[model samples]
Target: MDYAKTERADALAAGYVAGTLRGPARRRFEALLPGHPALRAAVRDWQDRLMPLTASLPPVAPPPHVWAAVERQLWPTVAAAAPSPWWQRLAPWRALSGLALVAVVGLSVLLATPPPAQAPVVVVLQSTGKDPAVAGSLVASFSGDGRAVVARPITPVAVTTDRALELWWAPLEGKPTSLGLIRADGVTVLSRGRLPGGLRGSGIDHMAVSVEPPGGSPTGQPTGPVVFYGKLQL
Candidate 1:
């Protein structure tokens, strides 16, 4: 959609940050973010601007219908059994109150924890020649929703000011796509939509990293030798 070039980018980014964008639309918007720094910056700005308002709001009990909607989201099978309005007496909101408590607790846990690192599918990247166990070992994992990928270094890997470490995904059958540039020590989170088809399911064959001119490869293709390579696993 070339959302990066359009006015809708701001609006879409706002919705994405607000937790209002959902399903495929949300995923699609996330996919667009990597190539557009301005959109990513706008989203970060919105998040910074909105978080305080969100935190300041008083917690209120949700209306009954809201619980119904949540049930539908959390348990579609349970929701479909009645096929009637949840307000109906026979629908038994009383009995479901206990289930609601469980739901609430579950939701709280989900909210309190970081999403990506929780039992994340991992890829272990190893550099060639030297001990694979030594410096330059990296771990790659995905967010619970598969909307982001995090790469964390287990050991040091050097990069000069004129160069950067760039990550890439090689799908089973297509050209590699840049995930993003990452740091050597700290964690780098790449917010993205669902991975390319080749990289998802069983289509992902490998992941690789290369040293590139500062900022990243300019031609959208790796211009330097791959320094680390790994088989991607879910």
Candidate 2:
């Protein structure tokens, strides 16, 4: 592959930075970066473009068990202390009441069920603005079964109370269709019932997020500026 080509490099770098290029493909891209200056430049450009999206995200502390596991790996001898008695460790169980225990069991059963045969499709919607402070990004994942989609903001988006963020499925040759109104600060799930048919087909060209009224576009089309947009890889 000619990594020097701008179009090819940009596409691969975008996927790499967005975390959609994974496993062997990701490793292969990294290996080529050292030998290809254009590829390296593309990667740097993408990092600069997408890194700002994390500015509004608050720091999250890891769980206690995660730290404990790290400490065990770092100092095995120190972590080999005697296990506490069952009664002494009751504190953890106290948080899991009878109802919670039943819920956990039900979740375990659900998890044991087989996953969808197809792999999920992931898209990274990048901000269209040049300013980092005002720009935002979002990651959207379509379930393998094509029955649902989960949209999550990379950072909190500031919007007036009267305005809202809306997702759209833009086709190759026509006006975009509204997927649904999405949140600016949290994950939003759109079920199959909420979505129109032919999502898994080739009719759709790309996905976009547009700023709109609180209840979404009154005209069944985007009324506000398109703040973020991305191409569909499917």
Candidate 3:
């Protein structure tokens, strides 16, 4: 009932929205929802904020290899000894060239199966330089779970000793939010909180890099020209 004023309630509502609250905690939350309007509203707010991300993802069927792996785990001996599907066991019918054709067909079936799901997204940030003389780029890759992102310079970026390169989350409909100061030539990991929530859902408008004073932007907003930018491909 006092969910609005408590950190614990907010966390529970978030976990519920994310579907990570399980078993007894989940049941308790559900039971509380009917008695506490504020708690129910809090859960609804989280759902509204996060559902689009989960909903937009298309369902992916597990690859054939996955089922094979499962079978091997459950019945290792049986899977290992399973007949070579009739085609691999075709040597007995060597006189018939038709057996070779059958083997080819079977092998084709196995090989033609679709590859596994794609890995997480990685964005390539290219120099926004208009002149050919300036060259710099960066690669931003999200963690496998999409909980964090890291940026690495692909081409060297030069910055003055008194300035730093800063990263920003350029949203679709608002001012860009500062991520943090990034290195000119090394890896820069953005904390999960700094990443735009939209990136996990619909997608971010873009990510940009700017040259700023050491320690970062003094205004909490970019004060320098955007030198490079790129969109996240989910």
Candidate 4:
């Protein structure tokens, strides 16, 4: 196959960025990347497109037990030493608990504040195939203000290097409208300008994903099988 071809390089780069191109295929792609400027450019483009999605997501703090477990693994002698006095052990825990309490209170205050007129909508796109790599669901969340949407896969989807995944908004009566190309194994954020207006109305029915040639369907309609779909509930 001609890896230098724009479509071919883009498809391979998309799979690599999404983490679906793995094992020997992944290694080969990496080895070829340095020799192929087209492949490198494709990869850079994909990274720029997908990496920004993380900026909108809030960070999650790991639980206290996880840190304790890491400390035990790294410092066995200290961890295995005779248990510290009850007060000594409790002291550090107390401080952590206090900080957690403050955070909870702040979050509660935020949640108690008045919300936007439109509530956020969540849709779960179920896989049509039984293949283990594509069995899990994809979650699409529409912001309460209807200004943006974020879609994330629950598991990495195994797709060929010659294919890409395309997202669609399938209305109740009309044909599906292409949202954009999406990574099979990563988060995709669509701004309001990219989404069709009035998505919360009855005209909005389902969100779907279809396989397509790299760079998406050229005819402006799905050319391959629809692999995942879910009803949109507002």
lDDT of model number 1: 0.69
Provide TM-scores for the models: 0.46, 0.53, 0.48, 0.48
The lDDT for every candidate, in the order shown, is: 0.69, 0.76, 0.71, 0.74
**Residues 1-234, model 4: lDDT tens digits:** 788897578667866765657799999999999999999998997677555644555555676879989989999888889487455566787968877887999799889975334445566576777343444556676765555778887556788889888888877889888878887778888756556465654267888888899989999998888888877655
What are the runs in model 2 whose C-alpha is more than 4 Å off? 1-14, 17-29, 32-116, 130-134
Q: Which candidate, 2 or 4, has the higher lDDT?
A: 2
Superior by TM-score: candidate 2 or candidate 4: 2
The candidate with the higher TM-score, 2 or 3, is: 2
**Candidate 2 steric clashes:** 0
User: Could you give candidate 1's per-residue lDDT for residues 10-63 as a string of tens digits?
Assistant: 556656765656799988878878988878976886566445433533455666
Q: What TM-score does model 4 achieve against the real structure?
A: 0.48
The predictions' CA RMSDs to the true structure, in order, are 18.3, 12.6, 15.1, 12.3
